[model samples]
Target: MKFSKAEIDAVIAASPRTNLPLSKLVLSEERQVRPQGSTPKLSVAELAASIKDSGVLQNLIVVKGARGLYEVCAGGRRLEALTVLAQADDIPENYPVPVLIVPTDKALIASLAENVFHIPMHPADEYAAFARLIGAGKSVEDVAAAFGVTPLVVKRRMKLAAVSPRLMAQFREGQIGLDCLMVLASCDDHVRQEQVWNGMPSWNRRPAYLGQLLTQGEIESDTDPVARYVTLKAYEKAGGTLRRDLFSDDDKKAYLLDTALLESLATAKLQKKAQQIAAQGWKWVEVRARYVFEEFVKFGELRKTRRAPSGEEAAAIASLQSRLETLRARMDALQDHEGDDDNDDREFLKLDAEGEPLEAQLKALQESLCVWPPELMTQAGCVVFVGSKGTAEVKCGLVRPDDRNGVAEVARKASEVDGDGESLVSLPSAKTRPVHSEKLTRRLTAHRVAAVQAELTVRPDVALVALTAQLAHSIFRDDARGYHRPETVFAITAADCQSDLPTAAEDLQARILDVVTEAVDANAASPLAALKKADAANGAEQTVAATGWLPACLRTRREAGMATEETLQDAPERAASEALAA
Candidate 1:
């Protein structure tokens, strides 16, 4: 019996399964169900490994072709892998591949059925499956090898599977997203994870803030200077616990749970540094984990006098500089030759490695020459504090206020002997510039705005003229360039004012109604529409320039005791309003 491609039900339902020699299988043209020029879904090597680990679990669909060969219409990728294994001698040349035989006319339909009808497993289900395999005592590496994925992938899936069951159910139900799920998985405390998830409102459950909530009490090793100084390796050696973030691409990023231990280590290191600085004959040396500006501001600072380098030191500096220069020249040359060439890259890296230590050694030699005089060291003190980059920093030549005068007196006495006196050395002075920072200037301007608002509230005349000028500028100015900005802070959003009753006084309302009624009557009664209306329009236009006339809304609100016409005439904005009218 023959079957056509359109007969999917018959072809898929009753296809006979058989084994065919790997050598007799050929890929058919209709097997390309994926889009043209698209990358293959699975790596051929990975597929071959999977097939080698566990023989083909899914049978390929094929049709009998010319020359007694079976043409693979579906599972072409598997056929490719099998062919590769056979060519590599990993599998026998005549190895039998399991396949389902369908009619030649049903080839395309069979291919479509295999490719189109295949549904991928959900991520949550995959994570659970991996967990089950681990529970079944399969190693992560073994599972990765069997699945053609890296061990990291398997471990990540296992971590996701470790999330709270309630949260995972939410994830499966689409209540929680994969990103938030991964964040919750960062912490292994299932109870804490559930508490955080349940405590947060839907709107506030972002991944970043969720991570912050989870690590609220923990110190970040990546940012905390003390952690950087003590180093994660040392902290671990000291038996401190670290909470690693699996979601973080950087494995080195973690949270130090024991902050007290971190501080203790940092303090001990700083103390050891302080002891070395004290041995230089300073009266006192204090060690602080962090630098506090307010605590050190009370003491006077001394400047360092740089002495010339010694003969041996100068020669060493020269040698290091020469070596560094040579390394830099080599690095620059290697950079131009950098590309697919691995040798040039290795040479560049080697030069860089050689240059860094030489540069550091040269800098240390230069800085060591700048020393506090022995006369000044006895009068001043030293402070060893941790700098922002987590390096130990020393602040020397800090004389107390009482000690400052005593040192000045000693210098005065010494000046009497030699008659050439040394000036009291002071800390570096700031370059002359704007005294107020941008932030402070903004704050001061804000206070001035408040003050101006208070005074402006009582001055209605000034407010009216200002508002009139502002509106006039907006309406009549040429500001297409967008350079003009309204000076007033007021937001003027216009809306239609609807009312059942007239807003003006009753007498004023009656007069306006009479005038409008008269104009309508005249226009209707006259044989020719009256030229009187044009005369009125001319007079109104003239009135604008003649009397500086403004609409009542545009007119300034006068103070109770103030004379309106005189003040309006004298106002600069009123003049501007007149010019606009003209």
Candidate 2:
């Protein structure tokens, strides 16, 4: 019975196998190679589940025990699992177990051999085997039950199995790793999988890149704003397709295929909301999937004015406010007394329930007082679009650039009227078009240009300064301003100007000239530019600005009155007698 290593293999080969009833088998003390309670409880539970699903698979090595019971020297865990199953009534008390009977002397050696020499199946092989079982007509749930794992685990393994054959071959050869294979498995198209793998450079074949490339052109249901707006269920209901990635932890990590459908749905919903707003008598209403600030910044927005609330509305607002205050006070008192006492807690909950609705009613009543005049609504427009957080957005009282002049005229008339009186001149509706045709516009601009050119010849200083500024702006502009062409005629450039001016001197000098010219002329430039430069000047700029002198081009206005000691003492009088005598 004390055999050398050479004889152990022959003994294993010659062992006799038989079935023994669970009631007649016992775990042997000789099988205590592993420390007592060393096995994890989860592993024991899984083993029990597996045994219950499809009786014990491998045979246990046993020896004759002290009475009629057979002692299991090897596979003590299997014995424990069978006992657990029998106790739980999952299996009958006398369920049969497979065993290999060995001599009493060799029982310890058999136990050691079973524990130490056994190698677990490779992970790749296990996944592949699961795929094969599924392919052999077994359901995912069935396979999971057989293996004592959840269906999700089985699904993940099956997803891995669905990888391109070429990639799988590379995985087996240890060329491609399991992580990269998982990403490839996320894409159901095998051709796409192989193409992605072959297209990637050797150094760039990573899981993250692989995942990104695989799901390119597909919208993510969870993270994408459009998809979140439309909702995954809505997209699917509209006959859209989704590609799932089982390896990802997020349950919503699926890609939506029909992006056009989502966009159409969003546009349609926006249009419906826009129609309701348009009924409020706006001149024009437009809808867009997204709101781009640059596209709409040039439009003028109407000023919002408030009207006094009516008598009934005012009374309701006061009542709601009072009720909200009372509810809050009561809730606060209840909170002060809240403790182990259930009555105080219940009262606090009841009072808290009334607070939100009353506050909401008061807020709604207050906001209802803000309104745009009916005349202004006719001049301005509205825009409806989707916001970045996937909700509908509305922008109202927007006046188009062409309509700003008309709207300003109406506002001026309104200001002149006293006590909400009607305007003396009737305002034109937004539907009115300009009376001048294209031909008339061309003729008018041509005449204006001729007069401007004639005036420019007499004012050489104005022409020179205009030419210099235009040339400087064109030469020293950033890439963001590259699209704007300088609207000037003289393209002056020479080494003489460059020699006279330092590279950095022109920028500061030009800005100073601009500020002085603007202050003298008092002509309003862009409102945005004025705001940006309002507080931008420092002490040096202020010192330069005190000169009060400007180039001829910017000094287009002429002052009729002179500021001298004589004029300060007495008002200047027009000499009318000389013309009357002629």
Best by TM-score: 2
Which 10 successive residues of model 2 have the least lDDT summed?
571-580
Q: Where in model 1 is the C-alpha error above 4 Å?
A: 1-9, 35-46, 194-206, 294-300, 303-376, 399-453, 459-582
Tens-place lDDT digits, model 2, residues 1-582: 454666778778888989989999987776657666677877788798788787788998999888899988888788888888888888887888989989887778888887877898766788889999999999999988877788999999989888877888889889999889888888889999999999999999999998889888998888877777778888888888888778889977789887788888778878889999999999999988778899787777776666799999999988998888888888778778736888888888888887878888888888889787777788888999888888888998888878868888887776566455443222234454433445544544454335445545776655565455545544654445333433222221211111111122222322543554455442422222343333333422443344543322212222243333322211111011111111
List per-candidate RMSD values in Å: 19.6, 16.1
**Model 1 Cα lDDT, one tens digit per residue, 1-582:** 444556777777788988989999988876556543343656777788789889998999888889898888788888888988898898998998999998877677778877766898888998999999999999999999887788888899999999999999999899999999999999999999998998999999999989989999898988988889889998999999998887799978989999888888888888988989999999789877788888887787766656789999999999999998888887888777736888888878888987888999999999999877667678788888878898999998887766767766654564566464555455334346543446544544444334335544776665666577667655654434333333322222211111121212211222332333343444432332243544444433332233333223323433444233334333444433333222
Collision count for each candidate, in order: 0, 0
The TM-score measured for candidate 1 stands at 0.59
Worst lDDT 10-window in candidate 1: 494-503
Q: Which candidate has the highest lDDT of all?
A: 1
Which residue pairs of candidate 1 clash?
A: none
